[model samples]
Target: MAPRTPLFRPNAYFATRSDVLFLGLTVFALYVVETLVLFYALMYLLLDQIRDAPPALESAMNEVFSTVAVFTVFIAVVALLVVAAIVHYGSGGTDTDGTFADAVSVAGWAYAPELVTMPLSYLAARREIATLTFDGSDPATLQRQFEAVQQSVGPASFVILLATVVWSVYILAAGTAGTHDVDVRKTILPALLVGFGSFLLGVT
Candidate 1:
């Protein structure tokens, strides 16, 4: 049997049974954290809109919603992995000794890049939001504030977003190839498709 790969090494992270389990858990944990960060930021953004609500009540609601969002993200991740595994098998890509579990494990670990990207993206967003001055009385002022926030975030955030997408695709391809015992060339297309789909899901 091959030795386990280090968690930080995307190409070999899912190479062994223990490594697969570890990476899957790590990715899930990171997803939960990311979801929490996103929800917390969202709650801050919406706080002024819900200013009439009690502070404690609003905080509790945000916490509950964040928890639910984390579970939703977990389910989505699992569903995506299952669907990808089925498609790979149906396409006769399972000619190697790898099983459905192996494919799912690799797919889960492929999300590891988000561990870094999500936090950085959130920080960038927070910084952008801080620069905006909201005016509830004037619709035009509010629109300008929104545009200012976008302009502030556009250049740097776009570069970060592009880098994250490319890094994720590369890692997914490597993980798919390593875990499924398929040639890297054969995995690239599926990896790219799935990576883009995941990116859209995350952003939306």
Candidate 2:
């Protein structure tokens, strides 16, 4: 039997079945927190653009609830995909030395990279939003201000976004490879496809 590894080290950890439930719960919680923080930051940006914005406490609360529902659905879909991938590849003569539970656990931990990047991205956006001067009464002025805000944060935000995505893809690839006993190269395409699919799902 292979030795067990710490859950924090997903590449090695997914190979073992120890603490799968705990790790999945932890990842789920982290993902929720990350998503909430991201949406809050976005709300701050949007609210900042309104010159005479109405009291938004209620609206913000509504948005939070809606976002939670969306993220819950998104995670569920991703979990199903992970299970399908494991089953399909396992039947293809590949030595996917792990089970459905292991794939789901790994998929959960695969989100760890975002724990770092999401908060940083939110901070960057928050900072840029703070610096913007708003004139929401005039649509053209508001658009220009929004554009300026984007330009101010665009480069750094893009870099962080890109790096986090690549980091996530790398983590997912490693988790898939280790859990499935497949070549790292074999996992790359699947990881890219999954990542892209998830992004599309999130946006829509």
Candidate 3:
């Protein structure tokens, strides 16, 4: 049974499958934030590399493009999963009569959270979590230090992965059961999802 008073009456389709759609949208939002934070971070590191060696211009460009491509594909896969889940839930948890448009729409909102979160973020905190910079005079030593920074990305990324999962579950539950009507409840789920999502992304 639908709520007597609609909770923040969304677009026509949103009302019909709010639970699934919201969850999908939230995760997609998180994904975009994670991607963007990574993009900026990569750009920052690449700039540093260029600063260190002006002669390696071609190599730097190639490295930047290759790195971006790999991460793009990785994020695309995550987006696909969110879209699929949305479609699965939108059609009342079955693929029997799902529409491609439904999934596409879900993917569209993924970028919204990034716009909202990026400006307000504490860049100082994010920097502390992400990078371990060294300014030693020896090239070999700096290279090793860079390698160490790269290695740390994995453990950092894993922690972010865990945060994203937990936040997803929490937001889904809140949006579904926190209030019969969506407009009134002080839903903590969205904030948690956004905060943790942004943090993980900032670190990445």
Candidate 4:
């Protein structure tokens, strides 16, 4: 039988704190841009609906706001998972690997985080737009805005979730296979699930 490897072996050349932080910040910046684009597209769609005239701008805006709110909730939930991942890896994992680089590589598991969080940011922007449309002083406005943000964030979040599942498997397979000098095809699924689940649970 093949010798068993350590559970947490880290690569010597893996990322440092500087690298992880830099990469994280860079990722966040890109996420913000993606959200901005999605918001812009949503606004354009809403505008078209208004132009069509059967559904007044007011109604279209309301529906859009509501949708955005749901999306925000979805994003918040996913964000919790991501935060957990950061905390686990950042604090030094219990895994056999002592290097931060090993934990950092777990970032390959963060595909869902990226997919979900970007859209959440867009929904947040949409909520801001909704506020401008709605009465500022209305006692109910706060609640309405919150709801709209949640709805807007949810749908896109689902896509992110799905993508993460697929990508996580790929990263795990590739990373582990490379580490052990094994045929990658044999390890793909295990690697992917491990990578994906670890990130989601913040145990990388």
Give the whole-model CA lDDT for all candidates, comma-separated.
Answer: 0.62, 0.63, 0.46, 0.44
Model 3: residues with Cα > 4 Å off, grouped in runs? 1-13, 16-42, 49-54, 57-62, 70-74, 86-92, 95-104, 107-111, 119-122, 125-132, 135-140, 150-204
**Cα deviation of 2, candidate 1, in Å:** 8.6
Per-residue lDDT tens digits of candidate 2, residues 96-182? 565556566666665666677787888777776776567656667766865665445455676776676667667667676666777
TM-scores, in order shown?
0.70, 0.69, 0.44, 0.37
Q: Which candidate is the best by TM-score?
A: 1
Candidate scoring better on lDDT of 3 and 4: 3
- lDDT per residue (tens digit) for residues 44-96 in model 4: 54343222233354566578766876685567446534533443333333542
lDDT-wise, the better of 2 and 3 is: 2
Candidate 4 deviant stretches above 4 angstroms: 1-18, 49-92, 98-165, 168-204
Worst-scoring 10-residue span by lDDT in model 1: 46-55
Minimal lDDT window, size 10, model 2 = 86-95
Deviation from native of the Cα of residue 140 in model 3, angstroms: 5.4
After superposing all C-alphas onto the true structure, candidate 1 shows an RMSD in angstroms of: 4.8
Worst 10 residues of 4 by lDDT: 3-12
RMSD of 3: 8.3
Clashes per candidate, residues 3 or more apart or on different chains: 0, 0, 0, 28
Residue pairs with clashing backbones, model 1: none
Worst 10 residues of 3 by lDDT: 4-13
